[model samples]
Target: MPLMHQLWLLVPWAVFALAAGVKFWRLTRPFRRQLAEPSTEQVRASLERRWRADQRELTE
Candidate 1:
């Protein structure tokens, strides 16, 4: 194949790869934000609160 034809064929693949990468980044954005904050105590407290609520419901 000629060099020009090869370059044209690669352009579509490059665009597809870039689009997939962007989609993946968007999907994981929420997880990335949460990891950036490092709020372990708050998460533990929230889980504890939910557990207490569930226990109360079960007892009642």
Candidate 2:
């Protein structure tokens, strides 16, 4: 509840959000544009899913 404690909590949370945002930024843009229609949607979805899954596997 103190100002210092609030600052400490907010600092790390802001850092984490910024980091995650930077990482995922523009990740799905190309895919989304190319796959907005029906046929390519499944393929794009698979690619996107695999990408995130691979990142998780690597991190783990």
lDDT per residue for candidate 1 within 1-60, as digits (tens), equals 999998999899999999999999999999998788558898899999999999999999
In model 2, where do residues sit more than 4 Å from their true spots?
32-60
28-58: candidate 2 lDDT, tens digit per residue: 6788787676677887998999999999999
C-alpha lDDT of residue 21 in model 2: 93
Candidate 1 global CA lDDT score: 0.94
Candidate 1 clash pair list: none
Q: What Cα-based lDDT does every candidate model obtain?
A: 0.94, 0.86
Checking candidate 2 for backbone clashes, the offending pairs are: none
TM-score of every candidate relative to the true structure = 0.60, 0.40
